[model samples]
Target: MKAAVLRAVGAPLTVEEVDLSGPGPNEVLIRVVASGVCHSDLHVMEGVLPYPLPTVLGHEAAGVVEDVGPGVSALRRGAHVVVAVVPSCGRCRLCLRGRPNLCTAIRGRPGVMADGTRRLRLPGGEEVNHFTMISSFAQFAVVHEAAAVPVREDIPLERACLLGCGLLTGWGAAVNRARVAPGSSCVVLGCGGVGLGIVQGCAVRQAEPIVAVDLWPQRLEVAARLGATHTLLAGQEDVPALVRQLTGGGADYVFDAVGSPQTAALALSCLGRGGTAVLVGVGQRDASLSVPITATVLNERAVLGCDYGSAWPQRDIALLADMYAAGRLKLDELVDRTYPLEGVNEALADLKEGRALRPVILPWGDS
Candidate 1:
């Protein structure tokens, strides 16, 4: 198999021929069909998040099952599946509570697979770390069966890949975490792939005056096409003030999809009394945001942290697939472009430069 290896921090990923071991017990070997170039992946590449070197760094992906190891009864060879970044151990307290997104068993270490073994190796036999359990940047991935959410074959793998992370996180943040109610005012901070999904999710819930914020006019325009009733340029306007004025006070629900402390603070500032601020973006591990204690207490404002949109991959992915198939969700519209695996760096550059939205990577050439 060929995989892109990140050997050092702040370095371009090198495409090289790598060897992949067969799945271990309870694992599934998947042939990567498509993966999305996500901001989280860029964070890893830019050293915003710490991961060991020489790692395969992609998590948002969909693939076809090539084989299944022992004890993997839920999936079989030839099944179409989307890989979830976080794996759920059914016995965990969080998983048992129906919050698999916060499964304690898989919250910390992200560089290795379930069994604590590296499945990928360089041609010269050096082990390469796995990123987020599913290294879909490669041509093949060996992941725990729990990470593979089987999807309908009718859904295209390219679009279905978005369900693994960006789309799920954004949409779930609104629908599941914040529970944006109908007739409520909603504001999303950022207009990238995840932000756009939040906008669409608010739309689906019939939220009024959906406001999309971003530094780029193009992204704001795309957000409007998807669901945003209004758009605001980040630098040109006082975002929180404008949102407050537009919503008559402040938005009932504000989502920060940019993941920076600044955006997180802005999201909270854009919330009305009793409104909820949902943080969906992943910033530096040690990043901190300061909040006004008096306002939070007096105004009854709430701040919520969301991981992968607080979604259950098995259920949410299927629901998203159905919604896409039925035309209620706009998966195709979120995809700005596609790239071959060799162009992975270029795709990442585009994403970082805000030149593309949800660029799909075809590990195998687009057929």
Candidate 2:
């Protein structure tokens, strides 16, 4: 199979033929139909997040099952599925508590399967690391069965790919994590793919005065089309003051979708008394944010960190698929562009330059 492998940090990914092993017990082999080029992948390429070298770096994907290993009764061949970055072991404490997004069994582990074995290898016999245990950048992936959530077949795999990570995280952050109530004023920091999804989720919740913030005008325009009631240019305006003025004393909820210390701080600054600040982006490990303890205590503000929108893949993906199928959710509009496997680097470049939103990688090459 062909895959984009990152052999060095701060370098472009190399697309080349690689070897994949068959599914192990409780694993599924998928013919990856579409994969989304996410900011997380770019972070890995730019060394913002460190990982093992020679690894395939893609986590958002939708595909069809080709084979399933022993003990995998939940899925079968021909089943359409989305690959989840976090694999929830059902027996784990978090999974049992219905918080599978923070599965303790796989958090911060190396990019390997449950048995701690590499399923990908180079022609020279060196093992290629897996990213998030899915490695959706490749033509095929052998992922844990729990990481693959079966979805309705009617939804196109290309658009469904967004549900794997960006859409799920953003949508779930607003709907589940923040629980933005109707008529509540909500502000979403960053107007990328995830930010737009957050806007849409707020729209679905009937949140009033949805504010979208970004440095790019093009993205702000798209956010308006999606659901932003107001758009703010990041560096050009007094964002916190404007938000507080517009919402009659800060927004009820603010989400930092960009995942930087600066954006997180800004999100916190835009919240009203008793309001919650949700951190939705994943920043570098070494990056830290300074919060005002006195203000937080006085204002009774809460700062919350969200992982994958605190979504349970099996339940949330199916619900999202239903919404998309019924036209209640906007999946088609979220896709800004599509690229083939060989064009993965170009897709990443477009995303890094803020020229595209949710570029899907068609592993089968526009077929």
lDDT of 1 by residue, 163-217 (tens): 9999999999999998888999999999888999899899999999999999999
Computed on alpha carbons, the lDDT of every model, listed in order, comes to 0.90, 0.90
Tens digits of lDDT, candidate 2, 270-333: 9999889999988788777898999999999999989998999888989999999999889887
TM-scores for candidates 1 onward, in order: 0.98, 0.98
Q: List the residue pairs that clash in candidate 2.
A: none
lDDT score for residue 123 of model 2:
96
Off by over 4 Å in 1: 106-108
What does the lDDT come to for candidate 1? Answer: 0.90
